[model samples]
Target: MNVQRGSTTFLKVIIFLIGFAVLAVCIVLLPEAARRDAIERPGDYSLYPLLVCAYGICITFSVALYRVFKLLTYIEKKNAFSELSLQSLEVIKKCTFTVIFFIFLAIVYLRVHAQYTGDDAAGPISLGLMGILATSIIAAIVDVLQKPIKNVLNS
Candidate 1:
């Protein structure tokens, strides 16, 4: 039990680091890159919508990450089978689906913009596809995790 608690503590630290890394990317890297792109292509009005979608995806991802952290805390408290943990799992699943929706919108926006502008949308489209794939996997995992919790709660 001591070892398990120690492992959860370590996992929490890792999760915090992951969240911090994402925050830095959202705050520092994304805006800078977007500004540079806008300066280089001043007429690309489609950029704003794609950026909005990207931010939406990031926000949903942050919510899911926080929920995962909460779920971990529940586990550490030996309340992983409780309603709170189940709620956290459901929130994570919902967040993942929200991200997927944003990714899809971004992909469609990029594709349509590229069609009008004759720009190659391959890179962003590929990234969006991968994002969708990842979110789908996360949702599946959450579904599987929820089943056991639901079973425990119902019993």
Candidate 2:
């Protein structure tokens, strides 16, 4: 099946821009929370891991945005079911892994940080991470499984 390059590219560009905007907001907002000292007890500096996870998540979104731009340009010339979309999907699959990894890292950071100060915000952050991790995993699985089915149905 032929996908309309103009429409698909526009759609992907919109999504990419939204993601980039969100990441930018997160980068600007996270520093306030991250600046708090986690030195409640000896060796209780879980803040570093939280900062690292935040940075990782931001970087992952940045890479995904770059990939989306590349995919748009590539799809403009090539067929929908061509090798281009497959490669783009591979990049998306890797990003999903990164999402899952960062979510898990965030969960760890939140859990450890909460132990020292009993911060109320940590619980909600951990819950959010769990939700994101689950969604990313499901999306990745669907993308991986749906491709073969789509190809077969089209053929």
* lDDT (tens digit, per residue) of candidate 2 on 20-96: 68676676766756555543444655566777877787777677767767766766665445566666667767876
Find the 10 residues in a row with the least total lDDT in model 1: 43-52
What TM-score quantifies how close candidate 1 is to the native fold?
A: 0.93
Model 1 accuracy (lDDT, Cα): 0.89
Candidate 2 weakest lDDT stretch, 10 residues: 35-44
Error of 2 at 83 (Å): 2.4
Overall local distance difference test of candidate 2: 0.69
Query: For each candidate, what TM-score against the reference?
Result: 0.93, 0.67
Query: Residue 20 lDDT in model 1?
Result: 91
